[model samples]
Target chain A: MELFPEKYSQAIEKALERYYERYTAPENLYSPARYILSLGGKRIRPSLVLMAAESFGVPLEKATDAAIAIEVFHNFSLVHDDIMDRAPLRRGHETVHMKWNGNTAILSGDVMMIQAYELFESYPKDIFRDVVHTFNRVARLVCEGQQMDMDFEKEEYVPMEQYIRMIEMKTAVLLGGALAIGAIIGGASTTDVKKMYDFGRCIGLAYQLTDDYLDTFGCEKTFGKRIGGDILEAKKTFLYITAFDNTTDKGALRDAFSITDEEEKITAVRTLYRKAEADKAIEKSIAYYTDKALSCADSMPFPAHVRDTYRRLAVSLVERKV
Target chain B: MELFPEKYSQAIEKALERYYERYTAPENLYSPARYILSLGGKRIRPSLVLMAAESFGVPLEKATDAAIAIEVFHNFSLVHDDIMDRAPLRRGHETVHMKWNGNTAILSGDVMMIQAYELFESYPKDIFRDVVHTFNRVARLVCEGQQMDMDFEKEEYVPMEQYIRMIEMKTAVLLGGALAIGAIIGGASTTDVKKMYDFGRCIGLAYQLTDDYLDTFGCEKTFGKRIGGDILEAKKTFLYITAFDNTTDKGALRDAFSITDEEEKITAVRTLYRKAEADKAIEKSIAYYTDKALSCADSMPFPAHVRDTYRRLAVSLVERKV
Candidate 1:
């Protein structure tokens, strides 16, 4: 199981290099794309696709197209997201829009999207229809999720359930799509694909919950940014909502949310969060979904070693620091 | 042939209605889409698609999917183009970004693109691969054209040939794709499809050249906006470049381009353009391509009625009063 970690990681790195090369253009239109792709992240989506392919008894190289497609799609969303959020930095470097202009970023993002579709087109003709159909459905949901996120900005209230649905559409569905794509290409049955999708969705939810926790409590060395950015932006993350619902000292928490002073707001919100024990709730939720995700994986008909590797990766994703 | 115009227009109107109905949530998100789609442009690309389909003896409805796809893709470009150009109005009404925020405009444009692909996916499974492949290639070229357009804003010296290529990618290829899709789906031979694509490419170039001429000389009622906007913006339109290359009065032309005063720049540029007979040059260039486009369409094996209808439409487009 431990050896699988290094194996998939190396495979992802190599696949990304080839994928990036295939899409590069002679014009500088791809310069920003290259820059952003090279600004490294965890490559979690691609790794999952590769790992799922291996678990299905297909070699990692056989699943390279699906893995690359998912990665390109993920980065495409990130580029447009940075433009919409007015985010200047990504992975500690200038976002595509910040480095270039908005028009360049928008066009480059459009090209990246086309590139993603091109990668999907590389699959055999027998699977092409299903792959494209699935890709289109997932792409639409991602846009729907983005629309909901923007809608939340204007509304006064968003229920916990609605927020969860938004995350499912925006984040989890793509991860599930990644796994499902690998399974489909690896010749898995419809039942197995659905099971893999369920497994991936559960892990995706846990992954986001852990992200919320880390945003508040993680050390700078591990988390890569200052804690409480979501608080500063009034992001309506899980911790804030949980504290708002559970805390008895409502006055301070309410005041903290409205505070204009940054330091005062952070301190006040953190205090209320601590008193409500919101971190404990977040941790418990992460573990619950993580366990559910692993259970789904266990039910799959893979070899024991492959199943164990998938289970361990699920746990480590929720528990990892940097 | 005249009756065919009404038939195709109604078909396009219905398809656009169905296209707009696909978005169910967040009325605001769909509002801009509906607003843009309903603005009632000439439906030129879709008309080309239908005409090409009919020329090959395919029922117009069979080509409806490709027709709608091209129209959707065109509107997608317009929505984002409005944002990039910071234009306040489109089709004499508020643009998407003006009616909504830039984020809403951007996200809607993104969804519009996804819808374009989804519409493209409606083709038969046998033709699906070619449809996706061609559309993907055209999408990449459109992005390249947009990048070049932005690049032109910074560079003072743009060759005439480069400008032609830029517009070909940015504006013509989709029209080319429209005709190509129609022909392919209509069971036209590969040779016939190639000829139709050439027909579209040539006509699109002529159409743009005509637009350039009309911008400087056509009546406000006929042209739909202020005349000489390109001159005021110092845009490197065909007229400006041809005048720049041929005119003996360099100082006056340079002053016209460099002037900051709105009225002064407009008067100065128009004066030099008239003196150099740039209007005649523009007219000649437009006629040159229009003739080429008609010749290309004539050389195809389409029915005489189809050929004559297209020829009439092309001439009317360049010679219309309103």
Candidate 2:
């Protein structure tokens, strides 16, 4: 089965476009929101929301608004994170802060976050409360995760367990939250909803780990981004942190990260990553998470074909070159 | 009756302090939130929430969480707005962005916003959805208002109607929302809740207009801020906007605004304002809103004492020397 079929993407895009039509005034505030939404991401989290709703036998319309909310929220986070990171580009376009200004970006992102919550109001009262509560928890966790990520940048040491927890909170919980919201709206059983959340969490972990892996090892032709960008920045990805644990000579690994030349730094870091077998460790971790997601799918109430489709999604995500 | 009784203020302060104690981790994220909350303001909005609940015959405990939510959200906006406005001090203390940093302020503000929403979960399901929907709308309007305020700083012209709408959105709506949320949770009739909202809104307009008036004309010792500060900043306040409209020699007024010396500019602007009768106009508008608020309070379905209390509250807000 195809992963993230065109039908799903087109439906999401149409709904999002329709939702944003009401915000034409205050161009400075809403334009950045529209610009970021139009930048065409994979929409993976929203797709998980849709897929979970469908697997629970709900109509597409029942979950579309929640999906849009998740997408809008993700974009909101991206806009603010870009401002915080001082990033000039996103999806090969100027970020909101770069295009307009930081204040515009901040305020626009804030409005987008509120709009995301407003979208959830279409559900029934009980469902709305549950979904909002779930969203609130996940949103707070994402902020906490971001704080931890920023803190890690300045800290000299981060435990491996703490690093894993950081990735879980930063990226994985939102994926879990997306699925849980869809399932709850679909009237799924509590146990089944838990299973769906766990499934998304596992897949999210694998997806982020694979992304870290591909930054250094992806095929240049298919990766779409320049490989080794993370290496040049000395980002403490799974490879870097684990390599410190696995390498016999930690000083050499640190020296490799400290290389001045970009190309030389990438090569040296990749070599150290291999020598320390952190690459293999990360690959094993990725497989572990993917398998965990598959088991979660198997335990869920979805039928054989739906389970097969979910399995295909996990494989496709981890297998992506870009 | 006192506008905001000491008992109500103490209750709100204790509730807010208890609410913030749970957020100890990620010091960078929670500390700013705590810091801003600790710099106690009048707690007027939360007091409105508690007042509405009590007037509606609901237990104060039933509304304390929502009151805290409003207070937290108010501080969240302040933290972000201070960054955007480059404000150095708030309540005579260093702004969050100054005390910590811009990134910390941004992220901490974001978390505080999410926490505000979470506080509403203590309500029942239907009331939770209603209160959240109201909060969402008011919150978005506040952002739009801030955007318009910023835009006005750059633009040469703004209609008086648009300026009123801006102030309504920027400050009035949240006060209205506080009352609306409390009334909703208290099971007040829809019409009564709306009256409560309108009362807060009228008083809010009067309060903000009074603030602008005091900025130029208030006694420095009582106001706790420097007089004529708005003139120095050339803020497009009600007085400035009206003076521009009412003055015959617009060129002289413009030249007066461009005066290099701070004292001279204030004196010139004040003279121009009096010449155009703009100060009288502003006073008239303030009285209009105050009367409107009193009428709203009288129309609400409450005892004579409650209505009398509301009348006194509106009067005190508009009649304050500071």
Candidate 3:
């Protein structure tokens, strides 16, 4: 039932531990980076990087640096994003900006980014160029996505396509870029690299849509938190946008949004979402993206087992409650 | 009076203008970058990039992207640094964070850093890798230097050597890196590139020392701000550190630093600086570094005029009132 090779996950954890051991100086600037990294996530992106590289005939050892680089860059984005979001907690601990001050968080995050680029220097000339080129493009897109997310906060309505685009840029592209970097480092052909990127991107979209779905529809215990947290915040998530688009009782939807009591607001919005079939809409979109990911994986010039692994990864990422 | 070719500046301006025109989307993200760029600087770093490339026999046009990259990186640092420093003005305009908000400044600065790396993609694979390598090293050092500076603010005493190292990393290495990158792109020999980096580093040290000196001694009108601004802020500049190291009357120096009134603090600190002969100490350091820069320039593989132009640049940058 493991989604990826368990050994890949173990290797990644060891590599990250070795990598973070060097960040000891200037505690104010580097400690936050180390701290944030230590607060573990699923390590899915780095796992994808290793799996892609291995699938392309490169050993996990050869691609370890790129895997670490992707993970580091991802954490760098989180450190800064947490500051911008005014987020107090990450992974049940104080965020970087909360642990240190915002200024420390910003400076530390800046160094983390440079460190990510430095990780790519171990590669030879052509691979280094391609890897960094992909990094720069994806990094810029991530920033744009963050800006768009922030912009959406003040707006009354955000169209479904635009919201998807924002999430795609903000979240999906990095996943794609991570796979592409690993593939390039593994010496995959251009077509295979592109397909790997497409595969990761489709998986990322499906994963994010599932995240939205779980925020409302998931079991509180299984999801590890209360459901409808997004509704309480009146977030214009996929279900919110879809419901607004399809609901015949627009006034009731608006009134539901204006409800004063948090529990009542969550209940009313969930009811409206079900009535408009936004939950079904989100489920279909998730399936659509998941299918696209499988097709991309199937088209890759990998063995049948490798394709099956990717299929399982896509399924596990989207089908989970948490 | 022109230390560099007039056409180089003109070309740099045009190149920057053309480069910035493409940053139109997500007004909050790109506008701050554009706005920061629009507020003119001396263009010293970019000009160094072009001048170094040209000195190595590359055409000015060949180095425009690198030149712009260095400048953009500089501004990106400023945008983030201003946010950290809580400064309201940059080049007499509202700082990015002040004009918009801290979140915008942080995000915009993040994108700008990525954009700097993106500019390197146009080079051939080897050259691109080399240039980006130099950039990544310098960028990390710059962050470390900034952290050191912030660390110094809390300490009662900072060693003069550490202060110099901090400034060297924070301010000088970028200049050196910029020159080195240009030299690399222009096909300079490894020795020549090292010499170019040394020359720029020496000049940067001298220039920064002169900056510390002018903060207490220069005419307000010419310096474009009130003299002793560093003293007023109790900044541990070269003068402050050296004065504390050399001053016999430690109590009086401490008393001078603790003076509550603004003008009194300035006057007391300046008197202590002169008494310690820190003014003389700083001037000597500036002369020493400037001479070292000239020696470096003289040893480079260049024509007499090229060497002479570098000497003039060193003298002009370090010996200026502003």
Candidate 4:
């Protein structure tokens, strides 16, 4: 089954297309914001917004603003994060800071943050406060996650639970927040809204873990980004932490990371990860979360067809046998 | 007379003091946010919030959250701006990025932005949307202003009008927006709220012009910050732009600015500024705007004593013999 019954997907895409035409002055402040949206991703979060809203009979018009707002908010985080990481590229093009100066990126990103709330003005006034409160909580969590991600760099080890918490905050909470907001706006009951939120969040966790798996093991052409790129950066990702924590030869693993040759370093780290069964462990964890994610939908009080749509989304994200 | 007979000031200070006790983990984010607030400035913006609200008959208890929220958002912008400007200090102490790294500053600043809205949770439900919508607009304007400030750096000569426009966006709008919000929350009529906002904005413009005047002319001891500092940095302030625009001897002005000796440069620039009568002209402009600002209050439909409190604020800010 598809994410929704039908045409709402196209309606959302059209809404997003209309959103980019908003023009603000001092082109440097607004052009990057427009440009990033043009370099589109799958639009999964927004589509999920529409899906949740539609499932509860909320009109596509009611959800379009939120769909655009969440997408814009996502781009805001990317623009700022690119500057902090000093990354030269994003989505196979020059990052905001790389194309402009850091100051431009910072200022532009700041505007984008405010503009997201501006878009939220389209939300129905009755539940507007709830959506804003949820957004505030999620936005704060995302910032905290980023701090923890940076903090992990200085450490030899981050406990698996803390690592999981970091990823949930950094990557999953926005996804969950998007779904919950959509369901609430669609007039779903409290019980249904909570289930949708938990379902979205669990799937989001699985999504990140799968991304971790693909970075190390997926086909180079299929991945559409560089394979083994994180390893080259000495990034303390889930794979690195899990493998390091499981290994008996911790000192050797530390010294291996310092290897000067990029190819040799990737090779050595891959071997260590395999020996520690880190890849298997991560794959198993992804499966577990994916199952939990799908099960969250199974008991929802919604119609069987609406529940089926959720199961299909979870299966597509997990890419496992249903 | 003194922005609420002085007791509201104490109430606001106490509310702000209690605000810092919010505990968030990892200390890196919350601690710096607390530290910046502790390095207190005049608390003018928050005081204006409470002052405007009280002028409309709202009590201190009814307005403290907004007072605290505006102050926190102000510091959030400062923390991020210091990073963008790569400045080492603020309020006579090390900047957040200087004390921590750039990443910490960025993350902490991001959290503060979200937390500002979180503080608005205390607003009465009847007025919450009004407060949030106003905040969203002002926050975006502040970003636009910062962008304009940076953009002005690239140009050899900025028009006097454009310079004023930038400072109005960068500095004045937030003050105005704060007042407008406070008035709205305190049950002021729509017409009176607009007048309050315009009154606050005109005074904000005057406030910035006075700041520009003080940089070149005020006593360093009384200014409580370095004087001659803008001249040293080649920061084209209102004085510089006015002097350059009006001077028949433009080339000499340019050469004077290229002076390598810091002491001699300030001396030369001050002489040129005097020749152009930029100081006297700017003072005239300040006086004119001050009159316009205070007049905005005189026409308010409220009682006379409430009007006088505003008059006193205007005089204190303009600091001219009435």
Candidate 5:
């Protein structure tokens, strides 16, 4: 109760190490899985699983397997997505597909997925189907979301609503699913389970919006990444989508984006973004989703302090300068 | 009983049609899954599921979901495997990867794997874990097997035993798993389940051998293929591995395989194969595995006539001329 998700994060890390430590023979397949998991990131989704479980009074032991499953599944998606995106680094390390060849990455990623399912077998018998069905639904949507994103990439423009659905599926469902699975394992009532999912869905959307925001506005000191790189690539992120919606002059956006000079392009796009009110609109949207996420906690059956942690988590995630 | 696998196959085909007919939006993703399924595979694995369930008096209604799951999962692997091998066709139709594109195939194949799990959720609550667990172990091994196959392709030569194990993992495990799942659903005893798996393992080995044998020797009218394609590619099949093992001069085998002329290469390799007793060894090996497979049925808890059908199935599978 005192440390909330931070306390749960340590437990999840321990469980993940234990789950993957038993890696056996077939060095080719198991090594890539272990290697990818070893490249650490913020264990946010699994922490959500554990925090939700704890809030409902479920023991950490009961939630451990689901936490590990979410982490491993997330890594699995990263392995494949990195290949599709053709990115070279993840977590400041070589991505699985890049370290290994595409074939090895493909096969290892496939095995990691089954390994994710195998984790569910450790759950209590009564709730096994609930946990598995939730995972299946979420996993399927995640794939669909990825397909949508890839599909949209080739198109000149994507509708704002379609873009929202894309991120929700590709990025958000796993977050919501992790929460729902944790709550289910904690034996929460159906009402609370749905509420947690809605809460998670909003938080996930806000987190993605903030990520899109940070790509443009984040300091190199925090992210060590060049701002407006997405603009340079003509990525149709929230800002770009919102900018198109707000502005009548589409030619300016094209002109602003066509600048080859990095600093100039970023400055020009930012000016255009401000004129379209896209900057303010994106800020408002992040708040909107964050508030929607926090409001779900008000009706939650859990105590006020317990719900406050969720609000803190959402706010901290979406409003971060980083 | 008289209809045997053919009877079960009709039911499997019906279930598959119904399952896939629900295809909706996101044509990019679902179409490839449905397209591959529509390519009209023999439905052997699903039929095996239904037959195994029937042998233990498990009704078809109880088995259809698992049957469909196995078919979808098998197709999923085929889609991915084709991409890995860069094969252009499946069952004389454009492979999913070739028909659409690699990214679509990867994503669709991923969704198909999840769909396989989703189908398992439709199983009766009591047997869900058993069915799902069997599918996971088999699916994981299949990936491992595929990895081994790709790895072996890189090496100059592979040992006979390793080749056998690779196919057993890559090819046999799914058949074994499908049968095992059907038995579990039928409430068969643990001994009977193991027996079915063993029977399937042996049959899968023999079937693969028959495929290898036909690839080099069968009539094109029957095979609808170019004979000696494996020889041209120098694939590490059982025959090629055995040829390498039985020959004294590695140089001669290499020379025989290096011939660019199709007839010359096939004849040179066939002659070398005969001199090294590889042809005899392969025939003996196929019989050995087939007999080994049939022996598992000798002490089956089911009736003698029921056991006779399994023997007939194995014999027809291995002994087929076309």
Candidate 6:
């Protein structure tokens, strides 16, 4: 069975379509914004908002303004993030900063942020206040996460635990905030809001872990990017750090890190990961969190069918090749 | 007498103090933010919000939230603007981007934007929608203006009209939005909201023109920076464009424009401007708008004392030498 309610899925598609319309004017202003927003990825964050609202028996339309708010904010972060990463492409298309200049990207990103808050104005008064407050907290944490990520680049050693916290702050808190705010808007109980937050946070963690695992082991075609892009960049992924900490064959790992040759370094690191079973270890960890996230979703007091749908969705997230 | 009610001024000061405190925690996260915000140039934008709110009979405490919102947003723009301008310092202090890295400035500026919206959560529900709508509109315009300014740098012929529009969009719109929103929150009529917007917009235009005049004519010590800095940069200020439009001394003006030596360019531009009487012409235009702005304020159905204070303020804005 599908993991999300059909109504929730349908609502998200409609909201995204309407949300896309707001950027039609000032073509130069909105073009980059639309490009980044319509980059053909699954709108998972908005989906979580819709699902949480639907689980509380509220109609999806009522929750949509908040959902769009979250989505716009997410895309805003991506535009700026792409600029910082100097990544030329996102989702198989040139990034906003790359397609246009960095100034355009920065300005467009600013408009996207303003647009996000504008979307929030459609919510009921009390709910709007709560949403804005929640959003502010999440937005700050996102910046903090980015700051930590940047700081890590300069540091010689970053603990695995610190890296996880950084990801949680940078990536997961917004997801959790989206769900919690959705539940609040749907008039869910305080306990239900808290529970949905936990559920979303766990899923976000699991999803990121799955991404780290796939970076090393997934098929290049299925991943839609290079198989070892993260390793090549020497990104502090779980596989590399785990292998560094626990590998019996330390020589190859150290040699791989020290290698100045690009292709040789990736090969050397992958060889060390395979020898150390780091990829398998990460796969096990991904499964552990996936199960944990599913359990969190199941613990919520919702109809069995609805609960099962969420479980199925969680499983699909972990299982997807990309 | 001061234009603002005493209570309004005190309230703005207190609220800004609190707003500064919000940046106190996560010392690392806020140091750069506070450093820029506390640099202590005139807090004119926020002060305008407060004064406008009081003019409409709103309690200063209630207006403080919106006032701080505009200030935070303005500072955010300044932080990013400094980076784009390649400006090393602002208000006699090292800029955030210069003190930290560009990434830190970008990230901190992002947080400041969030904080701007967060401050708005303090307003009552009755005006919440209006506040959000106005804030979003102004935020978008600010970005649009920045883009236009960037576009101007590349374009060879930015017409005088286009330059004015750029300033209107980039600078005037925020002032209009600030006062207009303050009026709305202060429970003013729709007509008054519009009138206040016009009042602020006219003042903003006159303000920029006066700024241009002062940069060339004012005493070096009192100008707060080097005299003729804009002329040195070959900025398309009103004097330069007007001189280009009217003067038969194209050779001298072109020489002024073409000179690579900074000191030589400043002398040449000033000599040509004097020869064409362009400085006097620009001063007349400044006076024209200052009068126009005063007329707008005079026509408002405010108390006599308030109107008089506005008239004096308008005259002082244009007439004062840095």
The recovered share of true contacts, given per candidate in order, is: 0.57, 0.85, 0.97, 0.75, 0.72, 0.57
The better-scoring model by lDDT among 2 and 6 is 2
Q: How far out, in Å, is residue A316 in model 3?
A: 1.1
The best candidate by DockQ is 3
The lDDT leader among the candidates is 2
**What tier of docking accuracy does candidate 6 attain?**
medium
Q: What residue runs in model 1 are displaced by over 4 Å at the alpha carbon? A: A1-4, A7-11, A18-26, A57-59, B1-4
A1-322 per-residue lDDT for model 6 (tens digits): 4445566667767887888786674567788877887775777888788878877877778888888788888999988888889989989899998899877887788888888888888877777777777788888888888888887777756789988888888888887898898888888777888888887777788888888887777788988888778877778877877887887676777778888887787778888888888888888877887888788788888888878877887788888887
Tens digits of per-residue lDDT, candidate 3, A10-50, equal: 88888888887867778788888889988988888888889
Sorting all predicted structures by lDDT, with the top scorer first, yields 2, 3, 5, 4, 1, 6
Clashing pairs in 4: none
Backbone clash pairs for candidate 3 read none
Query: Which docking class does model 1 fall in?
Result: medium
Compared with the true structure, what per-residue lDDT tens digits does model 3 show for residues B1-322?
6667789889899988888786778888898888898898789899999989998889898899899999999999999999989999988889999999999999999999998998888799988988988899899999999999999999989999999999999999998998999899899888888999999899989988888899898889989877988987789999988888896788998898888998888998888888889989899999999999999999989889889999999999976777
Candidate 5, after superposition: displacement of residue A149 in Å? 0.5
lDDT of each: 0.82, 0.91, 0.89, 0.84, 0.86, 0.81
* DockQ in order: 0.62, 0.90, 0.91, 0.75, 0.79, 0.56
lDDT of 2 at B98: 99
TM-score of each: 0.94, 0.99, 0.98, 0.96, 0.96, 0.90
Supply candidate 6's per-residue lDDT for A239: 83
Encode model 5's per-residue lDDT on B151-210: one tens digit a residue.
888899898889999999998888889889999989988889999988988889888888
The better candidate by lDDT, 4 or 5, is 5
Model 1, B3-39: lDDT tens digits are: 2479899999988878778776766667788889899
